[model samples]
Target chain A: MSFIQRAVKVPPNSVSLEEARHRVFDFFRAACRSIPTIMEIYNLDDVVAPSHLRSVVASEIRKNSSVTNPKVIDMLLFKAMEELNNITEHAKQRHHIIGQYVVGHQGLVQDLGTKDQGASGFLKDFYKSNYF
Target chain B: MALRAALLRHVRIPAQTLNPALTLTGGKWGPPSLRWMSSHDDHLTKSEVTERVLSVVKSFPKVDPSTVTSDVHFQKDLGLDSLDNVEIVMALEEEFKLEIPDKEADKIDSTNLAIEYIYNHPMAG
Candidate 1:
């Protein structure tokens, strides 16, 4: 587990967007490197491959792609790093990992009943992942 | 060159006389004729490396398998984003069991580059 112990030091703020973009890629690589240990720790091999988890991490980063501010990107990256640390440390349970990442946002609640089939798109979108 | 040959003759005469004596003494040391091998000899061939590299690039979910070629760019030809590019490089690393440095990894944007990098890598087994 000593390998999992990363330097959690706070790097100085990026002076420009180019620097911030580099930091994001560095963080993304770090997260991808840890997927093997994360899979072993959470017993995710049965449901997900490393590539799928890699894409999931990328999608999570893409979710905040609209934010152009370097400071905001830094903050989001810090939060993402903290989440990755908690996950690699086994501070989370198997179902937590499954529900949050593997099963995806829509996999959590699927209304199989025909009664909701006639529901408006807005309601369905709201039920899916909060935002329309 | 003549002086060097004369020196070699003198050294070889002693070594020839000592070889049987050393072997008769049951010494652990062996003659200089023995050869040692290292993992360097277990290198992957260029064709095999290229084939595996292409397979890895084609397997990426967002890549159209048919559109993939040795010279196709991940972003321009395959239409993948930067993240997908990184993901593909990571997949190649996993396949070859080689940890490419970040600087070199960022440079591998196409199948040809990936194959060339992995093929030239001494420890890419």
Candidate 2:
């Protein structure tokens, strides 16, 4: 089991409060990186222009205005983290991590919707494999 | 579509109109009286500075402001942990258009305190 996961229960049943906190934070950190990874993969060259990206990013940041379901956030966070953990490539890791952070975060990810195949299909594939 | 929607949503919240409480005074940002209050409000009047804050802060569907009060600690009383604080700060800043330096932001314990700060702020006057 991962060093971090060990703090939680074995067999992945119940996570300690402390472990849960770390898991939430670590999950956010890793998922924040996932955005650019998908961006680079899809090669939307200048797809989301910097100026446009700024607005897009702002909406993403504003996603967590309400303290919506923390459970959903945690689930997504863990799912995103798992995706980043599985990647073997070198250059893509950075992008993957950043994307993960943006989408995984509370407010930032809210503005961003999962319309793009890059985020949904590919990213989902990453999450499903790792979460299991 | 999602990106467009998110951008539009943020664009809708005019920062200057933020702090629904302070709007009555027709000013933005906060006043200086805020530095005097305690860390949290334990008791006060119906128009208690903090209670007024709760009235409006809770209006937003996303944030349940009912839990707020003078004694309502920012993190504990209100469900606002950290990011919520950041968002509230942003909303407040946008409403008042005043830079609540991180130092002062930390001092804002209740809605009343926030109102006091806005009331006496140089910008408010």
Candidate 3:
């Protein structure tokens, strides 16, 4: 499933304090890896600037410095991930509208009326629709 | 005018050269200007920095490539808080092979920001 879909399985306010404490570090690790990707996706116009992204991340970490709850941290991190997914997905769709995201959508080619829609079918349809 | 709270504590970045992924985030490595990416240039190339970083993060049981993003909150997004930041800092320090001051720990939140900071700062070699 896509990133946003995972949020449905989690309750927003259900962060367990114990989990929050242990999970805070895990959240940071993921955030660090994701920064570059996030920068690429939301940075379409460079309007927000990389510094702002960094600053917000740093700011969030600062607030949780004292929290020892792992679950709480996990839920918080999960929320951020969901937001990022939503924003980026929206950005991708918008880009599709403007034709900027065209090349990447070639994955849809296989989904065309080809007999059996397998992964290859999706790719074939994706290329035909998006590329051709 | 706006007060910035302590974000993270001591995120250590290694002294080693970073990969294209992290290095590219700064103004180094390639042409100063942005040109269209060519077929020869796949975006996944990593420098020492990237490898070291990936090593540290990949060691963790939680992070997946799909879930990583710029806005993923360290605490909320990846499930990290202050103390974990400490471990992250130490790992980065080892990976990049440098010293990250405790005082500076709170400031390094995103890898993009860290790359930007490191590029501008004196320590990144």
Candidate 4:
């Protein structure tokens, strides 16, 4: 049996040039202003600096220059938000050593014993000092 | 020693015979203001970059400031892993207010390299 796939057509030039430019500028401005605060709060200052974030945003804007439709903008914004949330969630999970430890029997043995007793001891000491 | 003395003698002759026009200007072209402005922020010098980089490295809670030096390697000498290296590079990007490309950022594995990179970067302020 043969299957046929349908191609979807996208409308071009849906938004005015001026409107596109304004929206792009607004997006960048909002991103730059909030990125630093976000980095600080998330303890991401070490992993990604505000300048890096700005550069990434600028590149993303440049890449999507042809996108002017409001619906597309909303979709892109939603996608970006999802990506940021994922990064934040991943960072939060990775920030704690306990979260990195495996739960299954073999995984637990590998982490606590096979992986180096010194590191496990250090983790224990760190847990005691920081948590208790 | 002889070369040093000869250089000193040449310098003394110029100082003793200071240009009359320069003296008559009454310190109009004095270097003090130029030095002050240069230190204030017009440029990023090697020493300034070194000091700032050292301070940032020292600010890490796990790092001992006294152990930091220009010659120290981020991983080999400082015992920082790759993630810590990323953090340090990010901190440098923030301090210099410049976006270091990932390719270049990856190469900055030591305090000395960071100092050199910042000192040579034309856009660094």
Candidate 5:
């Protein structure tokens, strides 16, 4: 009940790139702070530590590092916040968290050797998840 | 009116005057060391804070452990970007169980500053 109330209370849109940057850091801190509860709810203790999860979240944000527009950043932040809210609220099941964040885009087989060097790009993508 | 004026004149006090006893005791009884017992006495030493801060920085995945030192800059020296800087600060916050304000957190760009800030923080433990 309170979670819904808190979720709906959005701040005004950031007017400048600087403001948006600060907001991103705030969001990052908020996400990092919630790692404990997320781990507990999803039973991720054996799989991931808080620091590792923090790095993963950082890397996810780093993927979009080229974006310079404040409005676009705000939109992206909203989506990230929504995803965080869902995860923390237990809207996601254990396997969902494990698959998306824990197992990662690499899928189950973390090939470190040259076995996949000869495989076609399509086959590699097929082996990986459907998402880009 | 006359009585009131006389009372006012007699009751006036000087600005520079202070209680001698209060000054002698430093506002409390006994010597300064024995005046109060607190957990602050066991605050983390500078060496311990340095070692812990270095360990946290070295443990960061992007940072090369061999390149990390007590005075290394997160961005300029370690080749990390701004986001990595924030991430390292967050890691330090978790390690120390301290919630550093964003303003102060922003200023901690190097290992020296992180060590100094944590060492000086009274509630860092």
Candidate 6:
């Protein structure tokens, strides 16, 4: 039996230059506003300041000046959204100290009040090798 | 063309050697010139680190400043949970302008530990 491969269809560019520009500007503004909160939650305030985040985003926007191509703008927007999602996820994970400790321990000990168990045999072996 | 070349030559050499010359040239050339004048006062002493660490610990809403001492532990003295401890470490990292590695960060359970870490860090400014 012969397998047929279908060509991926590229979506038509429907967004106007003004709309794309506005979207990019809005994305930057939203990202800038959230930088402080993201930094606080993710413990990145030391590494990344609000102004630094803004300048970085500004540089990215300036680097890509293909406003005429809506697809390019869409790709940029999608990347920005993905970045925001990643930061948010990191912040959420790192916001609590317990999670940080558990993660740092290389998942040896699982959390309390949770049925999720770690590698109990490995943990035993670790204790035997290290302690005994 | 000759005059412009001479002017460029006059501006370029002094800009590289002297900051004041660069500033003067920068003023003349508007914001187009890339004369990066970075100030060099980014060193923090041990005493400053101690003070900053104390301040950061004290600033925690749950922690009482009157009861807080350098030797006080986050969990035992301040009654802070692990989350609070993480936040405190993060605050110290922000205050000291340095990244405390996960292992070291975990070990910083007390104000004194945080102070010592920040004080020893060469890049903490």
Compared with the true structure, what per-residue lDDT tens digits does model 4 show for residues B14-123? 33677675763357666555455454456777888888989988986557888998899989988876545766777677778877776687688999999999998888
Per-residue lDDT for B12-55 in model 1, tens only? 74334555546634546754434334566778999899889988
TM-score of chain A, model number 4: 0.44
Model 1 DockQ, alpha carbons vs. true complex: 0.54
Measured by lDDT, the strongest candidate is 5
Query: Model 5, A116: alpha-carbon shift in Å?
Result: 8.3
lDDT of 1: 0.85
Interface RMSD of 2: 7.9
* Residue lDDT tens for model 5, A1-132: 887777777778999999999999999999998998999988899998899889889988989889999999998998899889988999889988887787788868555669868787888778786545
RMSD of model 5 against the true structure: 10.4
C-alpha displacement of A59 in model 5, angstroms? 0.8
TM-scores for all candidates: the values are 0.79, 0.32, 0.32, 0.40, 0.78, 0.38
Cα-based lDDT at residue B62, candidate 4 = 57
Superposed on the true interface residues, model 3 gives a C-alpha RMSD in angstroms of 6.6
Candidate 1 RMSD to the correct structure? 11.2
List, in order, the clash count of every candidate structure: 0, 45, 56, 0, 0, 0
lDDT of predicted model 5: 0.88
Q: Give candidate 5 misplaced runs (Cα > 4 Å).
A: A109-127, A130-132, B1-38
Per-residue CA lDDT of model 6 for B28-63, tens digit only, reads 556664544533346677787778889888877778
Query: How well does candidate 2 score on lDDT at residue B56?
Result: 45
The worst-scoring run of ten residues by lDDT in candidate 5 chain B lies at: B26-35
Q: Identify the CAPRI category of the predicted complex in candidate 6.
A: incorrect
C-alpha-based local distance difference test score of model 3: 0.51
**Candidate 3 per-residue C-alpha lDDT over B1-125 given as tens digits, one digit per residue, 9 for 90 to 100:** 12332333345455877565665545556676566464324322235445545455545444565665433445566776555555556556545545555447557765555444444444443
Task: Write model 6 residue lDDT over A33-103, tens digit each, in one string.
Answer: 56567767767655445544444556556667645687678776776666575565563455332233222
Model 1 per-residue lDDT tens digits across residues A50-115: 988988899999998898899999888887888898898888999888888898888866877898
**lDDT digits (tens) for residues A1-132 of candidate 4:** 111111122234326656545444544454555566566665665565455555555655566656757767655655554444444344344344222211211223344555455676666555544421
**Candidate 5: residue A118 lDDT (0-100):** 79
Which candidate leads in DockQ?
A: 5
Q: What DockQ would you assign to candidate 2?
A: 0.02
